[model samples]
Target: MNLRKISTNLKLPNYALAIAQDYLPSTFFQYDFKTSNQVRPAHTDIPKPNFQEYRRKPLENPNALSSESVDNRRAIMSLFSFVGGIGTLYGCKAHLVQYVLFLSPARDVLATASTSVSITDIPEGKTMIVKWRGKPIFITHRTQQVINTERAVNLADLRHPETDDQRVQRPEWLVIVGICTHLGCVPIPNAGNYPGGYFCPCHGSHFDGSGRTRKGPAPTNMEIPTYKFLDDNTLFIG
Candidate 1:
C-alpha cells in the first residue's frame, strides 16, 4: 500500500510513523509470527563497589594519644599508690602503739630492781608485812633477847638449818619472805608455839626469828630477798 494510504488505514498519527521508523530495526517489518515461552538471559552491566576507597580511609583518629595525657594517667596511679602505702604504715604504727600501751603496766612494775621502806615504820621487837614484786615480805625488828635465842638454836635440831647471823644483814633487822615454805601460805608473826617466830596456821609450820624452819611440815627456810641499807633508817629490798 502507498505510505499515506497505509497510515490512514492503520489510523496512526504521522508523528508516530516517523518515531517508529527511527527507533525500530529494518527487520522488524519481516516478522515470522512464531513465539517461545522462555526467559531471556539478562545482559545488564552493574557498577562495582569501590573497595579501595574504603580500605584507604582511616578507622581511627589521625592524632595519637598525647604524651601529656599519658603522663597525667601515670601521675594519678602513682598518687594512689603513695596514699595506700601511707595508710598501711599508719595502720601498723597504730597497732604498735596499742601493744606498747598493753605492756606498759607490767614494764613499769619490773623496771625497778629495788624498793625502799622506812625502818622507823617497823617498831622494835615487831614483825611487819609488806609487798614486793607481788609477793609478801617480812621485815622484823628483833629484840636483843630474840636475837640471842635464834643464835643459840642448835643447827642439828633444826629442820632447815641456818644460823641467825647468816639470815640477817644487821643484828636488829631480819628480812625474809612471809610466805610459808610448806604451801605458800602467809605466816602470822610472833604467834606460835615457838617463841620469837612466825606460824603458818594452815599447815602448822613454824619459822624461828632467823626464818629457819623449826617445826612441822615446812621443807626449807623462808626465802630471803636481796636487800641492803640505803641509809640508817631506809632499807632497800629487791
Candidate 2:
C-alpha cells in the first residue's frame, strides 16, 4: 500500500499518537525529554565560614549581661575560692595540733622514779619482796640480833667482802635485788642455813643479812639498787 492510503486506512486516536511520541528513541528526536525534565542545580558558592573568627567573637544574645555584672560575678567566684582555701588550711592546722597533743612522746612518765613502800607496812624482823623495773627487790626489817650477826661476820672469810654498814643506808632496813648472785634465781627469805638471810634452793647459795654471799657457787653479793627515803616512812626507788 502507498503512504497516503496506509495513513488513511490506519485510524489512530489522539491519545495513541501521544503515547507513541513519548516512547520514541532519542536518535529520532533531536532533544532528550529526560534532559529537559531535569532542573539545573544553582551554582551557589557559599563562602567557607571563618570558624576561628566566629569562635573569637562572643555569641549574640538579647539577654546578655553588662561588663560590670560579669566582673562582679568573677569577683564573687574568687572570694568563694579564697574562702574555701582558708577553710582547708584551718582544717589541716586543727588536725596537726590534735596529733601533737595526743601522739607526742611519753618519755617523762617512763623515766620518773617509782614509789616503793611505807615503813609502817613492814614490821620488825619481817621481809617483803617488791617488784621494781621488772626485777624482785628485798626489803628487810632487821632486828638488833640480825644486825649484830651481820656486823660480826669476818670480811676475810666472806665470798663477797662488803661490810654490813656499806650495804645499808639504815641498818634496820636492808634493800637488795632478790636474784641469786650465781644463777639469777630468786632466793627464799629467812629459810637458809645462814640466819636472817636469803637462800637459793636451786644451787644452795646462801646470803647473809647484809646480802653477802656466804656459801655455795655464788660469786658476788646481792645487787643494791638506788633508793632514798622520801620522808620518815616512805621510800622512792628507781
Candidate 3:
C-alpha cells in the first residue's frame, strides 16, 4: 500500500511521522493558516467555511472589549496595592515584636531596688556606706550642731554651697551619694579635714557636708540618689 511505502521512505522516528502522513487525506484539505511567524507555523489541515460571507461586522463593537480590559487593569492594580499594604504591616509587626518582645528587654536595667539600704548603725556626724540602687549612699546623722554649723558657715568661702532648702532630703540630716564627683573615686569621710569635708584620696576632691563639690576636678555636685526617711531614727535609701 502507499502508506507503507511512504513510512519506509521517510525513515520516521516513531508515531508522529505516521500521524502526519495519515492526516492529509481528510476532507478539510482546502484550509490553511492566513498568517504565521517562526514561533508558530500555520497549520494546513483545516478547511475554509462552506457558506459565503453575508454581512460585515461593526468596528465600534471593540468598545466593550476595551472597557473590559480597563476593568482588568484596575483589578490588577488594586490587588498589587493590597499585597503591598500587607507586606508593610507584616514588616511593622516584625519590628515591633523584635523591639518589644525579643531584643530590647534583653539588656539589664540597673535599678535602685536592689541597691537601697537602711541602717541605724552609723554614729552621729559619721557616715555609713550603704548600697542603694547600685550606687553608694553616704548617710550621716548630722548631729544637732551639724545643722547649725552648716547654716553659720560663710557662703562666700564655699565654692559649691547649698542652703537648707537646696537639699533633696530633710536638711537636719546629710544624705549624699558616696562616689567622688571628679574621678568616681570613693572619698574618705574623716581624713584630716580640708575645712572638715569628705576627702577623695585618689585626687583629693573635697565635698562639703551637703555633698556639694567644693574642690578638685569633680565637674558637678555629688549626685543624690532617690531616698526618703522612714522615721526620725531610720533612713530608707534607693
Candidate 3: list runs displaced more than 4 Å. Answer: 1-90, 93-112, 152-162, 192-196
Candidate 3, run of 10 with poorest lDDT: 51-60
Write candidate 2's Cα lDDT for 1-238 as tens digits. 3323332345656665566567855354443223145666666765655556443233344246567366666777899999999999999999999999788657765564465677778888889888776788899999999999999888999877899999999989999989998989999998788778989999999888889998899999999999988887887788
Error of 3 at 38 (Å): 26
Q: Looking at model 1, report the run of 10 residues with the lowest lDDT sum.
A: 53-62
Better of 2 and 3 by lDDT: 2
lDDT of 3 by residue, 13-73 (tens): 6685567667777443334423334575467655766433442232224445655466666
TM-score of each: 0.55, 0.54, 0.55
* Best-matching candidate per lDDT: 1
Residue 20 of model 3, lDDT score? 63
The lowest-lDDT stretch of 10 consecutive residues in candidate 2 is 53-62
In order, what lDDT does every prediction score?
A: 0.82, 0.80, 0.66
Clashes of each: 0, 0, 6
Please list the residue runs of candidate 1 whose C-alpha ends up more than 4 Å from where it truly belongs after superposition: 1-105
Under the 3 Å rule for N, CA and C atoms, how many clashes does model 3 have? 6
The parts of candidate 2 lying over 4 Å away from their true place are 1-113
